[model samples]
Target: MMNRILLSVSGVLLLLVGTATLLQPHAFFATEGITLGNDPGLLSEIRAPGGLLIGCAIAILLGAFRQSMTQTPLILSAIVYGSFGLSRLLSMGLDGLPSSSLIAAAVVELAIGGLCVVFLLRLKPV
Candidate 1:
C-alpha cells in the first residue's frame, strides 16, 4: 500500500539523517548552521532532534515489518514532514538565509507530506 511505502521511505530518510547527525553533527552544523533565533542552547536542541528521529525511524521500520501500516503511522509521518516544511518556509520567509539545498529539502518534505495525506484519504476502511 502507499501508506506502507510512505512510512518506509520516511523511516529510511529519518534513519539516514539521524545516522548522519549522530556521526557528523559538526559537519551538518557546518554545512547548515542554525543560530537559535534568540533562543539559547540551540545546539542541544539540534542534538536532541536526532535522537527522536532515530527512534521514530526504528519504530516505523518495525511497524512496516509487521505489515501494520495504517492511518496513525501515516498521519504522524505526514505531520512530521509537513510541520518541518512549514517551519522551514516560515523561517525562510521571516529569517535564516535560504539556500538551494534548503529549498530542495522543503520541496521534498512537502511532496512527501502531500503524498501521505492523499494515500490516507484513499485508504479503505479496515
Candidate 2:
C-alpha cells in the first residue's frame, strides 16, 4: 500500500520533472518548477542527477513497502524524507513567501515522510 503510494507519486513526479528539465531548463527556472543550487555550475551539476533519480525513487518506494520485503528502505525514507520535510518547515523562517511549487513539494514530502516515520517508529522488536 505504502509502496504503491510512493511509486505512484514519485514515479509521476520523476518522469514529469525529468522531462520538464530536459525540454526547457530556462522555462523550468523561470516558473520555479525546479530550483537548482545557487551557483550556475552547481545547478548544472544538480541537473545532471535528476534524470534517473525520480525513477530510482519510484523503485525504492515500491521496494520499501513490499508485503514481505526488507525494512531498510522504509527506515531510510523516514529519516531522509522526514528530514527534507523538516528542512522545508524550517525554510518557512527564511522567507515570508515561497513559490507554489515549493509549497506543494513540501506538503507531499511531509506526507510521505510522516507516514514512513509513524509506521517505522511504531514498530516493535520481536
Cα TM-score per model: 0.82, 0.62
* Highest lDDT scorer: 1
Model 2 steric clash pairs: none
The digit string of per-residue lDDT tens for model 1 on 1-126 reads: 556777889889988887766656777656766433424476567767888878878876665566655667677777878888899899988997588888999999898888878887887778
Tell me the spans in candidate 2 whose CA falls farther than 4 Å from its real position. Answer: 6-25, 33-40, 48-52, 55-59, 62-66, 122-126
Write down the lDDT of every candidate, Cα atoms only.
Answer: 0.76, 0.62
Q: Model 2, range 6-115, lDDT digits (tens) per residue?
A: 54564455556666665555667778755554687866765665665555555555654574543555665565567767788788877655787787888887887787
Candidate 1 matches the true fold with a TM-score of 0.82
Tell me the deviation in Å of residue 6 in model 2. Answer: 4.1
